[model samples]
Target: MLVKTFRGAFVCTALGLALGVLYGGWTALGVVAILAVLEISLSFDNAVVNAGVLKKMNAFWQRIFLTAGVLIAVFGMRLAFPVVIVAITARLNPYDAVHLALTDKDRYQQLVTDAHPAIAAFGGMFLLMIFLDFIFEERDVQWLRRIEQPLARLGKVDMLSVCIALVVLLVTSFTFATHAHQEGGVHADKGQTVLVAGIAGLITYMIVGGLSGFFEDRLDDEEEREQEAEEAAARTGRSRSAVVLAGRAAFFMFLYLEVLDASFSFDGVIGAFAITNDIVLMALGLGIGAVYVRSLTVYLVRQGTLDDYVYLEHGAHYAIGALAVILMVTIQYEINEVITGLVGVVLIGWSFWSSVRRNQALTAAEPDSEAAARVSVP
Candidate 1:
């Protein structure tokens, strides 16, 4: 497993270097490396969150996620999405945008910066919602239950969070975003576009995510109810019912995991646009990030990391919340990618360390279980 993990990283590094050499040699290498590290650091929380969903997926889907999903992430969203965004926002033809980027690198960079605020806002709110939902929602943990019981019962105030973020974004976009305008007549109609884009992104995420959560909760309930039915039927002689129900439960779990993956990817796709306008660079950076994230998911699943580290999910969720706020701020204020990466790394690192400590404590408490079983065995 260790070898496999290292091999994947090596493959990505080689691909990056090759791309760099083909593009601009040493300059491109520096760009890819810097972007790779920045993306990896900023997206560790994504790995943590992904672990939670990936646990429920079957091996086949997991493989697909690693392979096809990387293509979507690295190339589709990273490279193509930025081009798409510029085409839509700037009213430029897609081919024209591509031509501009390839020929006039400086102009292309400027266009990318102009397009960032909306992208940032979209990602920011998406992440914020993840955090708020996680923090406020009920968990299986006894301690978390005690702390979040009131908030969980009251339900997530997502609308309120969106409203506040919008108000702030509008204020900042009016003031700071105007100041940031440069030589090109790329004056974004900050008022209407910011509100529409931010709200649209927020609403789209909420609808999809909320529907996904609703179905998931219903599935959980159905599983429990079916199990009870199976138990009751077992008293008579209906073994077949239990097997059928179990199969249904498994299918439901698969659907749930896919929806969850989509939710997690929403912010990541938008966030990719914030770094570079060069579709190639964006794809390379985000693709590398996706590879590591998927690898980490596989690691987490095989090792049962989430089951072991009780608070790791919580920490990741908190980081998600922070990312949301940062995204919102970026609607008006241009956040440095390096800072974003550092924040994510710090949060995830803290969670990892905490989980390790908890696992050690758990091991210490169960010190004699292995020995006890060994001594009793023939």
Candidate 2:
């Protein structure tokens, strides 16, 4: 499993090194290595959350995730996305954006950074929705019982997450519109750009989720399910395929995965600018790390790790919440990527420890609890 999980990551590293050397020199290899580590640390929680979605997909879509999805994640978001954003923000042609990135890297990165508020608002709101929806779900196994239970109850309200997100955006964009701090003489303003971007993000979440849900439900309707059940019975639980190979459902799931990847990349892209404004280097470095993250997501799904660690999703969502707020705050200030990475690591680590303790308690109590039950029955 270790070899299987890391094989792609190793390959990506080798490519990164080769590309690094070609792009610059031996020193570029070191930069790529650092950026990969930074991206991995910051996105560990993303892998966990992705597993929750990916497991529902069949083997074919899973393969696509490794193959096609990797392309979207690495190049689509890590490379082309920044270029596209620069083009849109600066009103430059896509060709000029790429040219600017390749030649005048500093100006390109500045343009990207100058678009941070809108980027932050969009990504932050989407991620906040993910976090809110998770925490508000009425699950039997609660992590922060006191707080989670109330949030769960509040989940009964329709669009609750959207309301909360909009409220926060309104306050941030208005309250700090003029007072936005300066970075390298660039002002962070919360105006139409931020609001429009945020709403766009919110709408994106709804549309993606709705489309995926529609297809998923149609695929699992009662009649088709019974047919599947009958087929399974005839073949000892091995059912026939039905457009399941990158099917409609899988297609929507692909879109969802891409959007999710974009959200996660939003922070990494902007943050990478702070470290190194070179788009080529950022793409190579972060792209390597992004592949490893996808690898980790697949590993978690195959291993059923989420089932073993019940609170793991909880921790990941919490990390997302923290990241969402931090992303928003970062629009007006510079935050160390190390701090961002550390916060996620802490939450995930603490949840892992809690899972270990829970398992131990269950194991320790089994014998005594069974004995007591037997005695009572007699």
Candidate 3:
């Protein structure tokens, strides 16, 4: 289990060490260790949600996530993403941005930091939608039943989650604007930035989510899919409809996962600045942590942990809601990263323990002792 679950983690640690050794020797290694821990703590909820999405994907796409997807997650999102943000915000070309990262590290960090409002708006809104969607879903088992059931009922309203997200955003923007005005500050630009970034996030969620849901609907009718598969087998001597639809579903699912991962990374990237502006060191450490998260995701998927611990997803969505609120709050006042991490950890841990208790009750109530013994402890 260790080898299977943690192969990616091992590879990432080795690579992190090599990168540290080449960059700053033993001191760099220590920095790498710190950053990795920071990322893992910040993004544990992300791993749980990732597993939920990954379970829908086919084996080929799953492998791609572990391989090519890792490159994209680490290099594309962690390293290049910061550079690209700096480039766009600072109005410098990508090459110049790289030079700035290496040479004028302070300037690069400041550029990224300055762009935090928009980034926060976009990421916070996107993640907020994830939580709202989950809470609004009709589920058989409820982790926070009293809170969730009402929200699920509220979900019947058209575009309810979007409406709620927009309302929260507008309220926050006004608070920021009012605070800015009292301090003799400008309001139009800040409010506009918030609105625009939020709309962009909403559009992104719509597009990716729409495509994913479309494919999912197509693949969900088991009878229809099997019949189509059989018809294709008889006519073309190849049962391809189910396979094709399933692959299409997995493709959209993969895209959604990557975008979701990016949204979750926004706060982490910004928080890393609090530690160091050395982009390479930050990437090395965070990259290692990301690999472990991905490994944990795979472990959850393969072990069917989500099925066993039904409320795990509930915990993750709750954490996401908290993170979204924290992101928006950071737009006005500085929030401690430790506080943010602790809230998510606490929510998830509590939910996990809740799941354990529920499992114990169900196991005890089972008529067959052998059947109870067969149940896995997630």
How close is every model to the real structure, measured as TM-score?
Answer: 0.77, 0.92, 0.91
Model 1 C-alpha RMSD to native: 5.4
Runs in model 2 deviating more than 4 A are 179-189, 222-224, 227-246, 376-378
Off by over 4 Å in 1: 5-9, 142-188, 221-277, 362-378
Cα error, candidate 1, residue 168 (Å): 6.1
Clash totals, every prediction: 0, 0, 0
| Per-residue lDDT of model 2, residues 1-378, tens digit only | 978877988998898889999988988888888888888988999999889889888887888898888888888888898998889877789999999998998788778877788898899889988888888789999877899999999999998988998998887677544465443355544566678888898899889978987887876784477776777777885555444423788789878887988898787877787678777788889988998998999999999999999889889989999999998787677788889888998999999899889999999999999999999994
Predict model 3's lDDT versus the native: 0.86
Candidate 3, residues 183-287, lDDT tens digits: the string is 112233666777788889989998998999999888888648688779878897764544467878888988898999899888888889888899899889989
Highest-lDDT candidate = 3
**Candidate with better TM-score, 1 vs 2:** 2
lDDT at position 99, candidate 3: 97
- Give the Å shift of residue 364 in candidate 3: 1.4
